[model samples]
Target: MMDRRERKRPAAQPGSRRRTAALLLGSAVLLAAALSARPVPHEVVVQFGDDVSAREAANALASLGATVLWVNRSEGVWAVRMPDPGEAWRLYDRGAERVTDAKSYSST
Candidate 1:
């Protein structure tokens, strides 16, 4: 007979592993839902004359690794859809200064 002071060991439950796996899956799903709940930023569109072709603007965006979501001509302008304002500024800054400099030089 065992001593009365000694505690008996409890048996391991069969579903413990399954319970742990389910908890992990539930946590992953919750994390994904939380992340996806945030809203996406709006894209920026730069418009030029319809005389400027989509191919021209697409090439400009491609230089910055941005996708051209859409391109359409309205009135006399061709509106280019860029991924977001950040990308728009990046592309604008990269080339705009040079064009401005060239125009100033030619005008003078």
Candidate 2:
């Protein structure tokens, strides 16, 4: 039996909030570290859609001063050299699909 004037008991311990905050901070740091562990790719491979012609894709890449390291015209795939990963957007604008990092490929 509880008194009407008695306050409700707190659901959580006083230290619980600090534990949650510390866990969140630790998780964030772990995620940031994990993401940073991967190497940044120096090049990317692009697969152009069927609607996009090989010549058109090639021209667009050339205009961007991007080197076409390797190309499989029949498959509509092009491995383009890009020093900056952010610059990969130029290829996307030209109708590229499955744009993936090709750091494993040799520039030669």
Candidate 3:
């Protein structure tokens, strides 16, 4: 008679391999969906200099291909969206006092 410890272990079932592949494929699909849902054309708040008027600032930013979402006249800030992250530097060059990422102060 063979001792229990001396017996060979059974081979892995074929179903387990299929289940693992399925799990990996599902994870990949979910990851792709998540990546597609991420935000694009990042939002930013551009605070204009004291010398710049709201209309002037808006026109300037629009000329740079920024989409103006909102304008805070009292605060002298314009909330705009740009495709490239580095576009904030251009806003500063255009007479923006400060340019901040809208995501930082957003509730959502």
TM-score for all predictions? 0.39, 0.52, 0.57
Per-candidate local distance difference test: 0.51, 0.79, 0.81
- Candidate 3 global CA lDDT score: 0.81
RMSD of each: 12.3, 11.8, 10.4
Superposed on all Cα atoms, model 1 deviates from the true structure by an RMSD in Å of 12.3
Global CA lDDT of candidate 2, please? Answer: 0.79
Residues 1-108 of candidate 1 have per-residue lDDT tens digits of 778679677876999989999999999999999988764444444544345455655666677555444444442222334334345555444332212211123323
Using TM-score as the measure, the top candidate is 3
Model 3 poorest ten-residue lDDT run: 99-108
User: lDDT rank, highest first?
Assistant: 3, 2, 1
Writing each residue's lDDT as its tens digit, candidate 2 over 16-84 gives 999999999999999999999775646788888899887898887777667788888485888887656
Please tell me which predicted candidate would have the highest lDDT against the true structure. 3
- Ranking, TM-score, top scorer first: 3, 2, 1
Candidate 2 global TM-score: 0.52
lDDT of residue 67 for candidate 3: 89
